[model samples]
Target: MNSFEQLKEEAVRLDAADTLAPMRGEYLFPQHDGKDVLYFTGNSLGLQPKGVKQALLQECDDWARFGVEGHMLAERPWLSYHEQFAAPSARLVGALPHEVVVMNQLTVNLHLLLTTFYRPAGKRNKILFEQKPFPSDQYAFESHAQLHGLDPAEVLVELPYSEGRTYHTTEDIERAIEGMGDELALVCFGGVNYFTGQLFDMQRITAAAHAVGAYAGFDLAHAAGNALLHLHDWKVDFACWCSYKYLNSGPGGVSGIYIYEEHTRNASLPRLAGWWGHDKASRFQMKNGFVPIPTAESWQLSNAPIMSMAVHRVALDLFDRVGMAALRAKSEQLTDFLQRVLMTVRTETGWALEVLTPSDPAARGCQLSVVLPGKDRSFVKVLAEAGVVVDWREPNVIRLAPVPMYNRFMDVLELGQLLARFAE
Candidate 1:
């Protein structure tokens, strides 16, 4: 029949053949009109894992049965609760277990790592990152500069994208790092940009930074679980990410961090220490000197938040089972299909919609940032009213992320059909 109908048939065939298609059943989606909504906001917040409630209840039951002793007696044991995350987290980011630690929220971990890594000296007092980073990161950069008694405007160098592009090229980024030369103390970037969904070349960027004598770090809030990463092999100096987004741990879930093994073993490295980071043998003794754990755990400021971490445990287990390789392979195909569908909508409806995210699959994750004609908010409202869950950024952009974990090919087809209808 019509092109939209043909697209629907193709979607159905693809869904039937998808190896990861059964994973759609593992999550709980928001309902509208007694049906699951067309959800494409996993880049903002992932769908809740179906097992989350049971996992949380287990911890609650343990707490009820054993009060203070639950620290050592709970099913997961609160004393070493965070240790469970190390192996899985390292696998997710491609690092050694000792280089990873589940800890505070994203910004808090960023600040803690900054305390140790953003060491300014003489001319080498600058931090380089992409333009328009997540607001929290921008603020952290400013405040960290202030903490060092330096002006943020002077200390922060934001690498601007080319005039016609929404994302920076790796070559451009490396060139900028070289241009900054000895002035750069650190080169920190979001492994994938939150706005454009651009996945930066972390390995090349890290090498470029090191070549210039600057440390390299990343905020993987959008990259973790969405992209294929190799932090240890890439020699990423440090990194941090939130669990609530791609990792799907729930709202305000505990965050995780990564530090290179060399940095972890540097006993003299500057850090804002807490008892939780003290050596396990002497930690309970409440010793005066802070003998930090010779691992990423040394950056921990407090014991694990059991309730929140329970959700994280369930989420990480899902990733461990399915693995990032499978997830990323599915992500590439799904995102490519979405792009084709968007192009079809544009062709049929004559809509001047601009997809701002990079076209190269390797340069992006699952999300696509689109700029509609007139940059109107009314269409976004229409989509929301129709039970389509997407994210809108200020000025003019709607971000849609069809997460490989649960989203289907049919979802993309439906979105294209809706866009055509609304445009008409």
Candidate 2:
């Protein structure tokens, strides 16, 4: 067994060795009981970047200074606020700015994308998703299917892993596509499963969906910013993501959506319309007809929320400055170190604390989903009391995300020790 003092000493050494250690000061880490909490919940809610406060304050000051004219006169010009976030946001997802837009919430964006992509006909009407999809997504898909006069059970197909594991492999997903054949209207799943942190093969999945004559989409709420994505190059039909997690855009920040360039100019593509989606030139013309914008902007359902947009802008700026490659490098090393240390604990205690996340770093992200032997809830509470802030999902999983931008290597070390001590 690793000595408690030895673990603490090793944590200090790892912290000293971390190349990204200095960046931890850029975020506000929570403290409790006179100890800094080992925060591992970035997959649920990211630690706030220090700059977010100044960004939000700038908006408040703009509102105070310009009042009604803030839309045009504010420092950042609220009218073009969403556009300011586009470049960095596009880079984060490997898309052209015109292919991406920030608007609405995650589920709302999903519904809107479904409106454009889920065209059910006589045979090609089913939407296939992974079994145990996030509850919100399951609800959205079911409700959307019902709206088109199709029974949810008949139109919504959930593909479970043949091996009965926490994650569904690419082979299993591709088989589902082949089985569904021409009947599938859309194949959408989480880019990274929220419960297992399993990063699906987007390129392969998209190809399979297209081969089967189905639309390909991804819910990236847990994947965006946590993992590197090339959505446009992958020829994904559409994708939606919330910015509050690894994007560090604060709670309820603006979500992003991507529509492939092929779909961008397709005037025939059906979408639920709104004034904000009209072409900018004709938006205020107050004309009777809705002239959709030529780009992904056409998907917007309402005017931009400048407050949320400001937060997004700050987060994107940070990403642009730090760059994804550098963050991902640290992410791989940090998570690898974490898994190694945690495995040691499992070996010492003979605990069935298997990591649900894939062992291959390329097939996962910074998040590690630890599956405990018994009542995971009690284990979660013990970790909580030990000053670790990991999150618990139902059944037996506890997710701990060591976000690269702000989480220190020592944080991961502390987490492993805390859990090991709890098990003892």
Candidate 3:
């Protein structure tokens, strides 16, 4: 590793030794120019596994065959379809089965969770979050503040990194919470930053917020399958994630939420409820009294979208087979390999392509955010023309995520070669 080589032979050798390499075959890679495109955008949207179509078709067939009776008679029982995700989704985020539920989209769940947790009182009414949060989260934070009759400018605390730095240090976040003190109503952050790919210290941040009697939550849109999480052990107040990224459940896939055990079992906790959240025992009794389930499902506003959940079930099955620990191990190596590849290109091109994401493995996942400030932004177009699927941020940054799920070491090598040639 010290004498990192840029040869294709070396990449092939590395891939040969990667224990999780064979799992790549499980996914369906899109063809480009008579070959598979080198996909490095799992952080944006993951490639679909081959199993998804069959699972979706099975759900459709059952729905057609059983009419209304599929709720109880068909495979996986439509009435309790959301229950199937509890255990596997819990494992993905390190929560107990009762603590997790798959329902609604990411932003909707965020609003629902905020309504329950972000109860602002006089003085202790501020919401603290990252400065550059994903646009949806930023909107949710501001809207929730407005709903509570609090001015966002006055009550929303945006945590910024030190000057000239790209990401907030764990100490910066912890200190920011301490600085907010009694005024911090909630501490919300994207578990893995969408742009920087910097993994925040969720557990420490939760502990710091709790010390000041503030709620701690996360929008885990990028963190869900991209990083190893122990939300239950971390004692995080609540969290939510979409399954379309690293989980690979297709575009606009169903999202999931996790409520801490303390909150789930607490009947006193107030939440906006609906028929789906009503207790199953007396659900059909024609009773008016709303009885919320003593679990995360209590937040459900509607029934499960069976088709979306069916595809999600297939993705979760893969997670169960290939554990998060194994995935994280490969992810670190894959990302590190990419960093080296990019560095080699930088050396060859004499261009200052800076990686803004943290170098420490503990502080990141599979993504590497490369900033090409003075270079031609057209390099992204060139990479795209060459059939490498990566993402670009405005003002010049190309985000490449070498997903451990399907990306190969050879892909990284080829990308470096492409960049080196493009520079010429």
Candidate 4:
């Protein structure tokens, strides 16, 4: 058999033996030419769970039946709706239940967490973050510095990668944090970089920041469902992630946050409060003082968006049933197979492709960011037309994520064949 045929046979064998292979049937894939497209963009937006529609319809039925009384009388009472997510979300991120809370969108939650943790005092007034984080995080950091009447240019420190490298080394990150010393008020990073798909060492980074007397946090937009996290054990001060990406909630889905339990228990900590964050027993008393709930729920500024959260609940439940350990094991193998396929394409086609994501499996997630020299949106469009779905970042990067929850080994093999056929 030819090399391509051998690869195809290998993929078929792998698929047949995969324990998680049955999960691919649970999602609704985009159709192209009367077949499921080779989808590899779960890092951007996950496939819709088949149960989402029924879940939303159930919520609608509850609303139609109960009107305002639905807050208490619905099948899943709207009054305590957000509570349902606590344990599952905590499990997803390796945090205590009290440290996790489903709340506003990703950026909004980051701002709220910053209000409590980014306290600039005396010499410690600067915020340190890795370079090229998601743009929203950069904006939040800048605005927070401005809010504190400090110049962002000085108060925000963007840690650059080591010379001639596309990603940061853990050692370099730790050295930079140490260099910042007392000037660093907070060290925040995207747990996995959105553009490069590089996973930072959250535990080591958190420890480095603490040694320098700075609070540590992360924007887990690309890392939440994509990487294995342990925020509580890592002693991470705060984190926030949107549910729409790898979590498989729909677009503009509800976001969740993790605040270390110690911070959650600090009643005197400053926050932008709302009625929903008040003590449950006395919340309806319409009291003036804000008595923050002694959990991460204290940061919430409004009631849960039940409709959006209903979708989130379904996605989180799936994670609970499958568990991160099982998902991560599959993720590592799938991503590794994708890398080998890309290597084969380069060898056969002689295409000058560079994978910008880390070669080390532990330093990255399922997403692989490839730089195809001279290829642009036109190439991406061609691939899309040919029944392969992927994400294109600006400049010349094409990001592919073979999500373990739904993607198959054959999908990776076919993608390799397509690249070899299309490359000039």
Candidate 3 regions with alpha-carbon error over 4 angstroms: 1-7, 375-377
TM-score, model 3 to reference: 0.97
Once fitted onto the true fold, the runs of candidate 4 whose alpha carbons sit more than 4 angstroms away are none
Clashing pairs in 2: none
Over 156-191, each residue of candidate 1 has an lDDT whose tens digit, in order, gives 999888888788999999999999999999999999
The whole-model C-alpha lDDT of candidate 4 against the native structure comes to 0.92
lDDT on C-alpha atoms for all candidate structures: 0.93, 0.86, 0.90, 0.92
- TM-scores of the candidates are 0.98, 0.95, 0.97, 0.98
**Lowest summed lDDT over 10 consecutive residues: which window, candidate 3?**
1-10
Candidate 2 residue-wise lDDT at 77: 88
Q: What is the lDDT of residue 341 in candidate 3?
A: 84
lDDT of 1 at 189: 98
Best by lDDT: 1
* Per-residue lDDT over 362-393 for candidate 2, one digit per residue giving the tens place of the 0 to 100 score: 88988888877766477777777878888888
